[model samples]
Target chain A: MESFTIVSGTAAAIPLPNIDTDVIMPKQFLKGIDRSGLGEGAFHDLRFDAGGRERPDFILNRPGWRDAAFLVVGPNFGCGSSREHAVWGLKQRGVRALLGTSFAGIFFDNCARNGLLALTLDPATADALMEVAAGPEPARLTVDLTGCSIATADGRRWSFTIDAGRREALLHGRDHIATTLTRTGAIADFEAGHRMRTPWLP
Target chain B: MPSPEPLFPHAPDRQGPRTLYDKLLDAHTVCSLDGEERLLYVDLHVMNEYTSPQAFTGLREAGRRPWRPSAQLAVVDHVNPTAPQRTEDVADESAAGQIRYLRRNCADFGIELIDLMDPRQGIEHVVVPDLGLAQPGMTILCGDSHTTTYGAFGALGYGIGTSEVEHVLATQTVVHRRLAPMRVILDGIAGDGVGAKDLIMAVIASLGADGAAGHAVEFAGAAIRALGMEGRMTVCNMAVECGARVALIAPDAITADYVRSRPRAPSGADWERATALWARFHSDEDAHFLREVRFDAAAVRPLVTWGTSPDQAVAVDGTVPDPGTEIDPTRRRAMVRALEYMGLAPGTPVRDIAIDHAFIGSCTNARIEDLRAVAGVAKGRRVAPGVRGMIVPGSGAVRRQAEAEGIDRVLIAAGFEWRQPGCSMCLAMNDDVLPDGARCASSTNRNFEGRQGRGARTHLMSPALVAASAIAGRLCDPRDLP
Candidate 1:
């Protein structure tokens, strides 16, 4: 796993609530197990017309936010399903952190496990950020995971938080399995005690 | 931090010093009776095209055929390709190979296989229940996590890893640790537009994703009983979202009726015996659960996730909670990260956001009923300009039936692509995907990042809500459409 921090180059605004997994990565891409190349197919139906051409009217096709790294979205960002591929897709596409009002429980856990930061803020702050980023030139947002803060280029900063255990794991580039392995000694000690107390079975 | 006390304080003391899960294990006898070993006596095993090829290989390598072929069923659904017909144009070689392997294995073992060309072929979850292969009071295992969808029939349905799949194929049994029971009782009637999906979303939001880990959930009470089979399936399908081992609803008349019409369901006298057995599978009137939670069905509304996690959810009308107020600093950071990724401000009205795409499909909500609901909303309405939307039927049968009923026409007239049957756009499994940075309103389960594709943002909602969003090109309540 790659451990790194990200700064939003230009804020891409998607002011939509309850964006589900199917719309983010449609079921069609699930045919493959390989994690790469999915970013290009990210929003197949939305970005392209029936003829498989890019829909110029789509927000993703717009020139201003084409290279945007920060996404300002509506409430309930990852709402449907528990597919972990959603996180892999986002991470591969250079989405280091997500800013939303709320998220689905499983989706949030998946993000934390994959070292992706999913940030929650009050609606007023989200709206302000989205408005600024939706402007012509694309506003820059900074996300410092070590600092646990997000800020705009103008120095407007907002504090964020993460689960203490998860924060430690993410900062160290360790996943749950790694954390579990750290307790091997303790587990071994417990197993030895159990064996001593009950020796009837092999 | 110390693990919280076992949610069920009295469970260990109940039933003569053994919990229900313990009893189940002992009965299976795959392990020692003293709780030192594991045992399994699975009643049903389901396989899909994506994960069964390796399992068949394992079986072949072991020089053992399926021990109980009668208990096994296979289907080709996941990689059927969303083209106009079920053809060989599948984009993934592994998916195609898996399908071919499933066909070969089923033919060799005499296990039922629903081929993609077969009208009966659909998503494993949808096909199993629709064909009545899942019955009440049985233990069912599938290679897919969404197997919990069969719990609506009162069966203990859950997913297993690939190794477990091989074990089940060769021995017709799986070693499993029983789970404590959690009861989620619904009281009162569901309000209009509130369906099983909303109920499950509300429960997950309240319990958090890991709340029911190591537990088997029993959905009960008036509102639950009132749900149709399809609705109940939707509720049970997402049980894993809360980390529950499974979710089961007691077999009832509705379940029996749904099964009665299925081709594989027991017939005549056998049916009567099966029904009697199913009726006995309910928890005893005095049976105790490890944890009990009650919800007033009327309190649930069309809910959606605002962040990346299922637990970080709110009602459509609710605003985002400020992370600073979270009691746990660690959780506060998680909330903040979710917000940044989702790009929402706390206290902002969730309904005000605009949507770029809308999708309605997946095992969680792609049943015929779900299609009908979306068709009802799409009828006579055009998709909002610049909004991309698609309706993928769950199965070939559902697709044909919808066409017969003119539901497809309604969807087509609304400018939504009426795709062929399969798990289309629900996951980035096939060619379906959202462009990078595109946000969408979807009806499938799971909103994990890029579940659709890399850099794709997903918002979970009911099918009607998805349709409404498609029509409005943003998040809008279905009730407001008319």
Candidate 2:
């Protein structure tokens, strides 16, 4: 995991609401055992066409997004399937943060473990951010987790929300697994206590 | 600056009665990080080949072993071909490689695995409960959304992502947030042809998708209590489609009877004690619910999803709804896209729409009871000409039961392909897939864009409706036939 305090970069946009995990990384790309090198397959169905050629009109396929480091998506993004390939695909493609009005519960949790910033903003701010990022000139969007706010190159700012635990982990470059490891003693004590109550449970 | 008000004013934190969800989380909390966040111990962890490989790889990369190997179990389902015998034969090369990888990983990690050749091998959702692994008052998880299926037994089980999967493998727990609770109460008995599938479909359609976001839903009322374990499973299995984190039913005599004498279930005095403990796991009278919706089960009819989302549904005999009927802009846009993709018109009667395929099987509705209902409709009849129909059992045990009663024979004589036990066509991860531009009536859970296959259009319905649709060569109601 990498520290994710702040980042300012060009933002790509996917305006489809309820854009589920199946669309993010389709079933066809889940065949391999390794999770690496899957960015090429990200958004396969929407990114490609019947002839296996890239669709020219996809938001990510445009010239302004070639260097995109962030994504502004619609509500309920990553709504289906529990595949981490969706997060892995975006992270591999260099999108460090996602700005959305809302996100699926599991997808939002997955972002925390991978050090990918997931910010939930009010609908007005989200719309404003997307409008600025989807511009012809490719406005640079700045997301500062430490400051708990997002801003565009033109100086419009909006405060967002993130829980203290997730904020602490992202700032310190730690994942939940590492945090749990640090609490090994407590976990062991809890397991021992649990076993005493239901010795029959497997 | 301070917040305007408490996020959940009536929650147990304010001395109010706690929800069933609260009890489950509190019982499993190993340690708390902050308000509403904790490392909750996982009692049972189920896995499948499609999602577990990378989790195992990550565990190996970090030089870690599962915190509790005995608490973990793995199965091969997503890519498993439903072809008969298949004892150990996986048809596709890539699928076989993944299956082999699962076997190797399970053996290395010392976790119990239901392999492809095992008689108990099936969808994780069905296998866990059939083997008595999912029980009351437990916290379960899997890397599959239908993991909500376990909630039928009064357990708390939900889907987790691969990253969370890896986290649970190494720690035997997951970092979780306290969730708001909602109760859906069904009061009256359903109509003659309506079933649990219809009831759940009606609930989702009424609320719209994303209606229960960030909440755990408790299903109650006389109608829910009257349903058998199989029917209860059908309802809980689709809870995720409503954006609910999990779905639960309070334990009762029916639940105790269902868990009485299975492989992993307790025996003798242990059974009596376990049941008594589970009996106390229900919500108290003073419990608080963020939102409550009541339904008259007698009013529900056989329903089908006409569009991509499960919430985009209508009665089986009704007409497709116009996108303009939706007030929310996002919902209107989604409906428009769904209609265009499905090649349907706003006023088109659902019964007049023809389909290319009729599939009756999935983690959502593949229990033996589902098979019996489908067989009851298809017996002594033939599938309409040019319509391909198939029945894939949920588990090997379920298939054997269906065969002992000659359900397979009835289906075969009715022109339906009697396939083996696996998650065939529920997801098009293997050989069972729809061709481009094909329309299918599926018994699976989700009906998202290209879910069945690339360029495929899916109509979600109950097994009975699928049978009737196959027999008529169109999407029709069961009551319309026979």
Top-DockQ candidate index? 2
For each candidate in turn, give its C-alpha RMSD to the true structure in angstroms. Answer: 11.6, 4.4
For all the predictions, what are the DockQ values?
0.07, 0.68
TM-score attained by chain A of model 1: 0.84
Interface RMSD of each: 11.1, 1.2
Worst 10 residues of 1 chain B by lDDT: B28-37
Q: How would you encode candidate 2's per-residue C-alpha lDDT over A169-195 as one tens digit per residue?
A: 899988678778998998898888776
Error of model 1, residue A32, in angstroms: 7.4
- For residue B20, model 1's alpha carbon misses the true position, in angstroms, by 8.2
Summed backbone clashes in each candidate are 105, 0
Candidate 1: tens digits of C-alpha lDDT, residues B370-478? 9999988898999999898888888777788888999988899999988877776776676677876788899987776566765677888889889998998878788
- After superposing candidate 1 on the true structure, give the runs of residues whose Cα lies further than 4 Å from its correct spot: A1-202, B1-37
Error of 1 at B397 (Å): 2.2
* CA shift of B446, model 1, Å: 0.5
Q: Considering only chain A, what is the TM-score of each predicted structure?
A: 0.84, 0.94
